[model samples]
Target chain A: MSDLASKSVTPGRDASASAATGYRPSRTLPIVAEIRRQASRRRTQLALGFMVLLPLIILVAFEFGGGNGDDDSNGGGAFSSLVDLATSGGLNFALFCLAVSAGFLLVVVFALFAGDTVASEASWGSLRYLLAIPVPRARLLAVKLVVALGYAFLALFLLAGTGLLVGTLRYGWHPLGSTIAAQIPPGQGVLRLLGILAYLAVILLVVAGLAFLLSVLTDAALGAVGGAVLLWILSSILDQITALGSIRNALPTHYSDAWMGLLSTPVQTEDLAKGAISAIIYAVIFWGVAFFRFTRKDITS
Target chain B: MYKRQLQIVVATSDQAFLTPAAPATYTVAIDGQLTLPTLVGTPIASPAAIYWYVLGALLAVVLLGLAVLLLVRRARRRRRVTAVNAELAETPLVVTGLRKAYKDGFVAVEEIGFTVERGQVVGLLGPNGAGKTTTLRVLMGLTTPTAGEIHVFGHRLVPGAQILSRVGALVEGPGFLPHLTGHQNLEAYWRATGRPWEDARFDEALEIAGLGSSVHRRTKNYSHGMRQRLAIAQAMLGLPELLVLDEPTDGLDPPQIAEMRRVLQRYATDGRAVLVSSHLLAEVEQTCTHAVVVNKGRIVASGPVGDIVGESPSVTIDVTDVPAATEILTGLGVRSVTPDGATGLIVDMNGTPRAELVASLVRAGVGVDRVVPRRRLEDAFLALVGDNSRGSGDR
Candidate 1:
């Protein structure tokens, strides 16, 4: 074997043997194919449907279960402030829905997309066939990652888009206002919403990264998704401890709600900046590890 | 003059967000437009945000740089591992010095090796837990071997090697996405290989599958035999140069099994090769041109089926008088003779030419109808593997 190591990979017969005539490793398992494969699954449809339906449910709750009771009394808290300004305009209601869901709902949705992609294939026993098809392991992971993130992004967009549409229709289109001395025109409000959504996407990157890593490590999709969400909950819990102090700032969930700063008059950049940076750093590390571990795995499943 | 006017306009706009208590710091009247400003030291953008953005960009660059460096290192290592040996260049498959020891101290295959050549239908004959599936798994790059080199058409086998694209395999059992129809699953698999559809030879493979209209039904609704046949068809996609199937006839009825045997024979007749594994010695004897008998994680015997069956020094003769034939055979210099049935005799030739026995029986009063080799592959297999034919526990 050691003597065999000095030889080149193929001696003139590479093009004529082994691979089929049209096979190309780079072209295998395109992202579109993976997206199509995942999109047809009932879970994906349910997930996207739930994203749209959640906002509608929230709107129905706001309309029928009306409680304008003591909005002013619950001041000084970020969530309470959003609640007080929920009906001020369509943009405010959309912002409120985002604020309520970004913490847990969006985290779970992102985890489901990233965490279930590879593990589901393994559970179905199709992974071995794909790997033996010689879909380069790195290319497979890359395609899955791209598709997973694409679906996650689509889910986020649907949630926010549906919220905006429902909120606008229910509460007439008006300028975004809050308890603070800030007023944004309807057009400007939509632009700010885009920026907030971008920040939310970045913040959820950490969840996607963790779930993707866990997906490669396990064959059980539920375990991978549940594990990622559980770890995030643990991080959020740790972030709640004041004694942890600056250590909490290093936690990925610490900046999960930092997009709230975008609702300010001049746009409070302090927390938003910290959140984006922290999210990027954590996402890079988790996703990098996932790729490394995946390419070398024996793929027994 | 335009620069100063622009500055005053920016100042006037900045005053709109200023706190009501803030003092008027700068006031100017330009082109009949009044400019108002409050708060002298407020910056247009937060310095901290700019700092974090730069830091984030730098960190991203560093991470990507590290990732690229790692990828290059892995690629170099992979190239080194995949270097072509070239010794068995024309052979479709060659495995040497193969060994696999699982994490729990279970040794599935302890130093086993074999090869499948072009135009040959070879059977890996073994009982349950004899490491047949394990060997196939390693050869297909589904699992890593502890120590070995598998060369497919001269190139060393590695996980996701481009060389593997020429090899089609079904190890263990058929694995399909339950929600997809059989046709869709096969199409999806072929598409994932990134080969052109025209090269798949779908019609030929489907003809071999014989599924007909069932091909359109979801795989979840398929029975075990249907799934097995579909998996075999999937392995035949692109009419690959080498086909490796494990227990290909596991759940098939007798007719389906016969159909598969004919399919494999035809597949090998076209200058390609097939390596099939099964515990049924009779199936191997009927379907394969060559057999590699393995038991307890070791090769016990291997060669053409006839060669193995011929190793037994015995022949069965259909005769007009079994008692007379047996008595006459015993009188000759043979090892033993026994009556098999009403008109048959089993005789151990004991280094005697089969023609000699027939010549002697014809000269005597005994009438010989037919003479066939009594030693089937089953006998040779049992003799080669002996009493320890049962597996040593598969990993």
Candidate 2:
């Protein structure tokens, strides 16, 4: 190799040919590689498998239990409460499913993706090698966050699809019921559902950002994941502590259920917008602190 | 004269083994210098807290026992021999006063200084927890040094696009996605670098790594040696100006270690520098032209391997009249002479070259058949690193 060519192949440049054309490689590839790595792991496969099979298990249980014809209190039947919840414009069954899944499984999924991302590399003694490639610390954290969010979105979408399909087939397509204190016409139900998905994406992004920040702070994969989960659980607990009052609104987890407004009659969007803004704010704060600390921290261990 | 003898003793293992009685100690007299043998004394005190102290002492003893066992095994498997040739060129990469401390106040590296020059493969020789890897990481810019600076090719190392571009490194164990094939791993690295995939270069790298047909196989299936070689190949790609390899031959067998030496030597011939850190002193002697011996996060000795190993004025004479030659050489005040059974004589001289000694023996009516120089970098490294009780001596 000539001196010129050797000089061009400097570390940290990502070695993309477009660099010669004044185009830098996107900082996203490393993040994608990490995601690909995690997805290939047996643990991730098992986790995803369990998630995909969850709704089916629920459907089977409800189907078998509802067959007894125990009660007919509402217009539908024993399962009618579920269907009414879906159509009653207040905490509909579908919206309730989104909130529950997002609050529970989505937190694990985000922690699974983000919290273990950098820590796993460190534990495997691969972080030094990756960093030796001269990758900037900031870029490294960015890639990690992107990968975590990618997994979070995929998990959320899978849960939503499974819940929607089973609920529609089992309870009939009567449109989504509301969870917030608003009403919506049937014509606007589809729009509201789309809006709810977008809002959930923001909420999950915040979760992923928190997990990623924790990953930077710890070398143990379990520590990062467990710490982030603990933080989320703690925040949820504190949010429910009535004495915390308005202070709960400041917790990022508080807005996780903001999509509840999408199911409300007349579509109460105020809370949803507040939730979206809060998610974005939390994401920025979490990611910014992670990047700053990671970039400045000395990786000795 | 004695310094010269020390060098020769270090140079030839054959002489050291043959004579077995040459004085192992030599003193140097320097003007205005205090020549004190500093023996650190422990405090004389009554043994208080007997149970806890006993437990601590027992733990220390057990740990020390394990360490000695490991060292003995390592030394037996790999006999370190340092070969210094004047034929090689010298250009140094200087690292000065490097230090790194974690947030919890654990110091990983402290005030370490060393220089590795051109045409020389230098090894950072130390045991685990010796901060060898941390120094390499800082050199590679993977970790920022809390203090001190590094100059590679006269360019001060600062985190930037330009500085990182010229350096290639493999720190710690090989880093590759397990599911990806060796080729795919390289491809991913290439793509991540934003470089257009070049099939020819990729193939060449795999070939150089000796992965050959197995390059298409998933890396998870690769043996430890193969993974290490692949890591080396990745560092060698794009012909980096300076290659910093950490435990490059860690898991390799004897044959693989030899192959690694050949590969690194090939890299050195390109006028590029290679800095390899390994606990295997013998391997370092074979591969590196320079050495920076570190223990406890600081460099004890850093220089051309030849200079550090110095020259030993010992000459081995393989001749039929071994007794006659030994007597003849000793008659001239060459007190360090020993007869080798029936065939050869070993003579240790003060600052005398092999040629001069052979001529002197021949002139004194002694037949001289063969004369050769000795190589001994291993002894020097052991002497520099010393026993484990030396607390942070290098730093």
lDDT of each: 0.83, 0.66
* DockQ value of candidate 1: 0.31
DockQ of each: 0.31, 0.07
Worst 10 residues of 1 chain A by lDDT: A1-10
What are the TM-scores, per candidate, against the unseen true structure?
0.82, 0.69
For residue A42, model 1's alpha carbon misses the true position, in angstroms, by 0.9
Share of reference contacts found in each model: 0.55, 0.18
lDDT per residue as tens, model 1, B258-307? 98898888777545789999998789989999999887688878888788
